[model samples]
Target: MTDKLKDKIEKFLAMCLKSKSEKEGDTSIKVDELTEEQHREIAEDAVAITNSLVELQRLLPVSRKLAELGYLLEVQGKITVKAGEAYDEAALNFFSDMYGGGIALSKRLH
Candidate 1:
């Protein structure tokens, strides 16, 4: 995909994620009331991200970077939740797979 298209897709995904995170807030406010067109756009963007990750997984170095990128994306998503914002699960899960189930574990002391 062209750079312009990729940028648009990324923005759409981010907006949808933000909308979801906002709904998780304690204030009990409704989401931003996105239009049907906006929802469709978000869905398309999610598909694009998933496809790109799949292709990137075929390359060793790129695959490694993809996993790290996934971790960063998940971290950003969690930060949005902590800030009382919303995030899309599709976007979160896409990265989760790349990062091997999404949570990093540390070894316990013996």
Candidate 2:
């Protein structure tokens, strides 16, 4: 999993584990409050992130989008290009393809 996706998962879990009232909410983990549709939506978002990362990795093989959003790393004093990270035509194309070959994925998420 990419760091970004891991972050999202962690955040979601934290939210789910939070209690509105330490008393009443202390009964048990109320994951049942989240409907099936809500769960499916979260799954969809995860899939989108995974697909985006896959394309990003393919566009820049030797890069590290898996750990960071933009791929600019120095190992042994060598630079690697992180594609689909810039606001250029190539990145735009990648985002478009990521969104079912249509619109661009949210810049903030990318």
- Model 1 spans with C-alpha error above 4 angstroms: 1-15, 19-32, 61-110
Write the residue-wise lDDT of candidate 2 on 1-110 in tens digits. 99998787767744644633354557455545666786677668768888999998787643334334322223322334455444343333443566644533465456
Task: Give the local distance difference test score of model 1.
Answer: 0.59
Off by over 4 Å in 2: 1-30, 62-110
Tens digit of per-residue lDDT, candidate 1, span 10-44 = 67666666766677753332234556676687688
- The Cα local distance difference test for each model comes to 0.59, 0.54
For candidate 2, the lDDT comes to 0.54
